[model samples]
Target: MTNKKKTTIKDIASVLNISAAAVSKALHNDSRISDKTKIAVRQVAKNLNYQPNHLASALRSGKSNLVGVIVPKTNSNFFSSVIENIEQVLNKEGYNIIITQSNESFKKECDSIDTLLFTQVDGIIASMANETTDLVYFKKIKKNGIPLILFDRGENNLNVDYVGIDDYASSSLIVEHLVNQGCKRIAHIGGYKRTRIFNNRIRGYVDALNKFNLPLDKELLIESSLTIEDGRAKMQQLLALKNKPDAVYVAGDYAALGAQQVLLENNIKIPQEIALVGFGNEPFTAMLTPSISSINQHSDEIGKKAAEAFLVHAKNSSFTQTLNKIILNAELIIRDSSNKKNQ
Candidate 1:
């Protein structure tokens, strides 16, 4: 004969000869219940294996306590750190997380948003895909009364909570550092500037050169797909130029890695014949043959601020009425790659 299924609250109450409410109160440690009765009820519940249904309770309370988060690129270290931090904060606040990566596709991003909404998420946090221009697609979240928090790479025109660093200032900082390194003729390898972050960096690069009275050489400015292979091609094209750059500023380290590899293949000296600086101080930067100098994106703090913003919106009933942007500060990380002394 098969054993019967585990007992429910009703079974516990029946065995104890008391009301289901009494058993529940006793299990929840209600002060109204006498100490003797609470002990007896708890013992009976333990014996009968009564379990409260949290999902049913949440449904009755009109709260799922679930947050949906979407990111464009997840392979990078910065994204990994941001997700871990968001998880830490959400877990502490007794909320659950649903994570999805869009891989920089608008269609996939939209589909992910739909799935999250279908799952009854209370709120959403997202980093827009590089190719995403249809901000109105996310208007459904607002229509459903869900607060959307956008972080890192996001839109300024949209009405949503945003947390990120001032990429413009950070870009300027890196440019100034390159200038101070005695590189008068500097070239920039630009990433996909359609995204807010890359565009800000490109602007910063141009502004710095103009401020320094250095002409923006069209030949020296190279556009990259932000991949190693693409960066290698950009570097090769630059090397063929009549006047090669003394210093090159790359937007992403993954591209820089490809460029560095090409430079070695061509016997191009780093920081000697050509200095290199990159954004996103990735872990591999420090371990490379010549450590890459880069802008510290403050990814950990960005995640922390995102968590704080989520808490603010989730806890405050008037959050929808109040809108504010939180921008974090970033600094330059000097390493062997950009140091003239390294050679």
Candidate 2:
């Protein structure tokens, strides 16, 4: 059996009765080429199943026209939505994106950076993993002079472009809303303090409690990985306390869902007995039986800003080192879970 040869631009040029250079220019949408010839070249390329040699193009032009995006998890609606918007903005500029999930692993994130670099990607936009405390691997990207942008879970130490919502203010908003609903003894189930965003949320929760003249009860503030299982376990622990909290504020929606499940299993009436609020306005938050109250992080806006930041860096040779931080304000979405007065 004979193996088939791969289709190339030359094949498309031959079929369209045009020079290979003209076909290349047409593929790139050069203004010098007539629209008629460009359309013909594209049609013939499609018919011949011709694939452009991106690696060769990158070597010749010093640009891969490819962007790398790293997220903690792609399964979540927030990350997936952000990725979609990023793709939309980048694709219009004739750039493609490669998405990689770290699954909250430091080693995996490092591996992903190495892989993207090996592929000669023009830039990398990433949200740091939960386990990524060391910034050595991140520094390597800068050392190689590749444009690096961090979003959501970012580090202040790294002077790179960043785009994310104001997590600290979001936490304060949640606390204020719960207080308005007459929740005095509010407990918080938040992410680990080592992560910057989680640390900000924890500080906001503490400050809000103090501002309301509520005691800073050590028993009421717990830190975890913020998974659904962690939420269930943390909620159970809160329930076992001698004086249980009247309300719970979770740092993540998935964990909040788990807490709600535990509450349902225990036959506890929501808002009436124990109010709840979650961060990250996931779709399921509103679709649940007694819809959950959550904070909208504006994933779409964050994605767009991140993509635009990459484009700016790619276009300007000297702008990579310039610090550009875009912080968006998050809005709170009220629902049945925490609406005590409406109940």
Candidate 3:
């Protein structure tokens, strides 16, 4: 069997009876090309299944028109939705995006940044991993003159463009709602304090508890990666306490789901026995047996804003402009899990 030759711009040009330069201009939709020629070039290019040599174009123009996105995990609704929206915005601007996951590992996150830089991506938008404490890798991106934007898990210390919801206020909203449900003793299952968003949530949880005059029980507060397994382990620890909490507020939906599973396995009724609330308003949270109350982080808006931030940096030659920090408000979504009075 003979291997078929890949179609190129010259092939499309030959088929269309036009010069290779004309084909290139037509493909790029150059203003110099007539509309009739542009339409014919595109149709013939499509018929020939022509693919542009992006690498060659990048070498000539010094702009790859490619963006890189790094996230902790893509399986979650929040990250997936954010990625989808980012793609939507970037695609319209003639830019393609490469998504990489760090799996919440700092070493992997550093590797991803290196890979993106090696690929010569125009810019990078990322959410830092849980274990990422050092900003040296991110600083390298800036040193190399690459536009860097962060979302969800961002740091003010980096002084880069950021788009995310106000986590501390979201936590306060959760505490207020749980208090309204008459939960006297509330437990918090949150992410590690090293992460900015989680630390803000923890602070908000403590301050909110103080605002309500509730006793601060150190035993009821646990810090982990907020994964499903960690959620189960933390919930189990809370259950073993001498005075168990009447309500639990987990900083992640996956963790909340794990806590709910543990409660159901132990035959403890939700809301009636102990209320539950989660963050990130994941789709499955509503589909669960006892739908969990959660905070909607506005994933779509966050994604769009993050993409726009990249565009801003990409267009500006001087990176000296004031950094854009967009903070969206999170909404408290009440559901069966924490709606004891309503249920």
User: So what's the TM-score on candidate 3?
Assistant: 0.92
Q: Write the per-residue lDDT of candidate 3 for residues 149-174, one digit (tens) a residue.
A: 99999866887888989888988999
Each model's lDDT comes to 0.84, 0.93, 0.92
Model 3 — which ten-residue stretch has the worst lDDT? Answer: 315-324
Model 2's lDDT to the true fold?
A: 0.93
What TM-score against the true fold does each predicted structure earn?
0.91, 0.91, 0.92
Candidate 1 residue lDDT tens string, 204-276 = 8899999988889988787787788888989898899998899889988998988888888999888888889
Clashing pairs in 2: none
How well is each residue in 1-343 modelled by candidate 2, as lDDT tens digits? 6867888888988887889999999998999999999999989888878888878888999998999999999999999999999999999999999999999999999999999999889999999999999999889999999999999998568899989988888889999988998888999999989999999999999999988888988999999898999999999999999999999999999999999999999999998899999999999999997899999999999999999999898889786465778999999999999997777
Evaluated at residue 243, the lDDT of candidate 1 is 88
The predictions' CA RMSDs to the true structure, in order, are: 2.5, 2.5, 2.2
TM-score, cand. 1 vs. native: 0.91
